[model samples]
Target: MSLSIYSIDLAKHSFSIHGEDTNGNTLIHKTISRAKVLTFFANLPPAIVGMEACGSSHYWARELTKLGHTAKIMASKYVAPFRTGAKNDLNDAVAICVAVTRPSTRFVKIKSAEQQSILMLHRARDNWVHERTALLNQIRAVMAEFGIIAPKGRHALQANIGHVLEDAENQLPDLARAILADCYDHLLSINQRIADQERCFDMLVNHSNNAQKIMKVAGVGPITATVVIASIGKGEQFDKGRDFAAWLELVPTQYSTGGKPRLGRITKKGDKYLRTLLVHGARAAITNIGNKTDRLSLWCKGLVERRGLKRAIVALAAKNARIIWSLLRNDTEYQVAV
Candidate 1:
């Protein structure tokens, strides 16, 4: 019998595949080496292929689509409930096969090569930033051990680190001074790399009309705009603005019971990096909202007074996320309320 659906549990070298016919009867279940995967799929008639979203899943999805098969990549959590046996590649593949056919399963957006490249840039920059922060903390701790204290803040550390290194009166040893000097230089290098990434983001924003359109929102800057574009092109996967906000996990978490509704804190799920950028941008907007009488600014002021500063910031971030969805999905600019 001809196979109607195929699910693959992907790995670095071996892949487990499970296939079913149109009548839901199992057709094939086996493992194939990485080299033979494409050749195997190339011979099959176009059918629905499913895989859990993970490393290299998008690349495989693109390849499968090129083979005239409809590929569906789903979050692993959605597929886990379908597994009938112990967790293994074959079982995972079977789970994927079952989950893909479910109507309510939410699938992840397939990122393009360009979008993936931009996200890689962001990841690299984020790594460097974390590394830099760690280095700074190390330097501070080492200096404190020698009874030398640099003032707080990055700028303060930058300003005093040199003097601390040069000062022979402090208890700092020659070895510790040399090590700190090297760390400071590394910090500078990481800073330069981060600046380069920002420049790349700036160029991306200039070239992408979608990024430009979303930047008109109050809480959207170049970083947030470019990230949103790279993460979701035109926001078409979501049916509405609230759906987009919910996907971002900016909405409150629900813990409702029978005939009762209860909402908790923000879910704090999904892409943490993207959520962080949105929240930081929201904080920046709120910090500078003084004396502004626009509708959004007025709303922010009232919200801050009513719900406190932190909740207001999250509310603004959620609102901005929705506005961004509307702007991108409709291919229109944000209209500022005067």
Candidate 2:
């Protein structure tokens, strides 16, 4: 049978595939074991294959592309509207099949193995940081139970924790002191791991031309630069900087009626990690923009004065996203306007 398009509902062990002909008639709908997936597709003629952007979807897409098929991955939300009946693997496969054929559907850009590896490092670092935060909070709460209070910041806690444990006159029981000591040790270990991950990011940024270029922009550090490179290689997937910013969901949400435009706060719908990094970076840039007369700096100064600090931070973040996109898309250096 001549297959025109194939949609796959991917899973750990089994995958449901829906195949259609040129006339949109369903030709094959069946579940296959993981091991046989590539073999099955390899046997068929090269065709357009679609899958939702979920865990392992990129791997499958890359594998399908290797078999001469045009692989496309769409967001799960985009595929949801195309589902006709009850939700299941087969129905999802059919929905993907239908969604892939639509011109308006936006597909995910496939990440290479190297990109995935960098992102893996990022995930590891982020996880370790969260673990450290939880450990800090737990330690503080336990200490507070015994009428002990550590200072406000992590640095203060680190500095005073040893003193707290060593002081014999405090309310902390021997057992509690031991436990708190253990917790502090664990926090130190987590901090070490996070530092190691950040060093890895630095090494990656040093090697990547794209990372280096984006890092030239204000508010973008090694972490942000490496993540952007991993997430979107050259930014070619986006037509313009504004589209890239919108993809990051840094743009405002819109609700228009009767030709009246109504815009609300940012959609905040895409990768929260990326959005957060950008915002934090923007905040840092704004804090350090002292008496600079450059065009970008002046604009940021004006924005902060006109819109207040919080909105200014977000606007600067969105602006940084656009600037990063432009640098990556054009393969050029960032120029500070006078």
Candidate 3:
């Protein structure tokens, strides 16, 4: 039988496949070992293949595409409602198959190996940054125990750490002093690593033309710009700037009945890391908006005055997401509104 579509529940050692023919008759249903997956698909006629967008799904999608079959990677949440029976790999595969057939189901864009590689740097840098923050907090706690206090900022801590450790009047025990010194050294090491990673990111941004274009937008820097470029590539998957902004979950959530709409907070539905970076960039831009006399800055200042700072930041972030979408979609440079 010629199958219309096949949905695969991907796993490490095996995969569950569910298939139906053009007349809506069940034709293939079973689990196959990982080594034989390609062989099984190869024997069948070219058809649409569906899988939940999870680990290894993108890689498998790429491989399936190479075999002359259409590959669709869907968000698991969208497929869950289609499950008919008890939760299991087979049932999940069936659900995926059902979901993929729906005309309105959204599929994840398959990321290339290059995109994944660039993202690795971001993940590494984020991990080290968290470690640095933890170490700083630990240092502050330990210093407070000795009746020595570090000030608010990282630079203040840097200035006071050596003095606290060397002060004889603080009566620091030998063991405690040695531990704190070791922790301080570790903190220094982490800082150096973060700096190195940032340097690498800087070089990457300088080479990427799209990243440079994104950076031109207000509030976006090397980190945010590279992330946008790496995550969306050409942004062709998004139909418009609003679609892209909604994907980032920057748009407001809505609840409506009787044609009366009530909007709430942002959906926050997408990548947490990227969303956070965008918000932080927006905050920075908002803080500086008052100092500038440009049209965009003046408009942002008006928004801040009307909506207050927090909402203003979110609005600007959502606006920037739209601007980013436009730049990527059109491959055009940003020109600040005068």
Candidate 4:
């Protein structure tokens, strides 16, 4: 089988492919409908195909592989520099061609159906959680204008609403109390949705071997485990533990001058949602169980004292990403050194 190189630009209704080889020689450039993309590739010899990572790109990549062609998915940002002239399908396709063949460029890993399914779960749960928070904040803010303050948390809302309403000596009028009562009911409804999603997450991570191994670390639990697993897809893409951590944006941002390197704030470069989950889990470990005397735990505990809670959580999250990367890469159990 011989290898041919081509770039593709995917759009809503149509697609374009720009074929070329090294030494700046053009081979084939044509537009095809979405329905015909697979058929067109099917006739071509087994070759290398490059496309930007976007919606449905993964599915197409899988299809291309089935047709015996190798697919390289590059981030759109990386492909932008190779684009010549206006940003249209042809130029974009050319950009992808240049980007994929670049030795220094990074490619996206192919995700299996199971990995995609788990990620769907994460997206659904995250949406529900966000909706819940938005409503909770609105409820609190609305109540504040009426001089009615619910307790600090959702649990406190029910009890606090009752207490404030029952106090005849309070300044809130009947209408304000009635409004607070309705908002509390709405807040409770959102809480129920969150609980339901959490139950779904529990069922998800419970069945996965990787998720179970990851949860063994101090800063990880069921939610964190699933998010990390889903976001990483297959761990084969990462070359090292720090590579995985850096992908999760767990590492400190880098700056160097005069051969002296300095670290600043976290790069926070990867998936924001996954990073947030890891940081949250790290916080839980530090506050509730960071002093277990294990190597990582002790290190995290000391970090909390030295760097304060927020920085400590970010640091531990980075460590946890590295540990996860190691676990997946080496296919070994996590050992807690005391």
Q: lDDT tens string, model 3, 73-153?
A: 999888999999899999999999999999889988999888888898899999999998988999999889877778999
Question: What is the lDDT of every predicted structure here?
Answer: 0.91, 0.91, 0.89, 0.81
TM-score of each: 0.97, 0.97, 0.95, 0.89
C-alpha lDDT of candidate 1 relative to the true structure: 0.91
Error (Å) of candidate 4 at residue 246 is 1.2
Q: lDDT by residue for model 4 over 59-133, one digit each (tens)?
A: 888989999999999888899888889978888888888888889899998876777877887787788778767
Q: What residue pairs are clashing in model 1?
A: none
**Regions more than 4 Å wrong, model 1:** 1-3
TM-score of 2: 0.97
Residue 130 in candidate 4 has what lDDT? 83
Q: Give one clash count per candidate, in the order shown.
A: 0, 0, 0, 0
Q: Model 4: residues >4 Å from true position, as ranges?
A: 21-24, 161-185
Query: By summed lDDT, which 10 consecutive residues of candidate 1 come out lowest?
Result: 165-174
Q: Write the per-residue lDDT of candidate 1 for residues 317-337, one digit (tens) a residue.
A: 999999998888887878889
Candidate 4 least-lDDT 10 residues: 289-298
State candidate 4's TM-score: 0.89
Candidate 1, residue 234: how far the Cα is off, in Å: 0.9
Q: Is candidate 2 or candidate 3 better by TM-score?
A: 2
Task: Give lDDT: candidate 1, residue 209.
Answer: 89
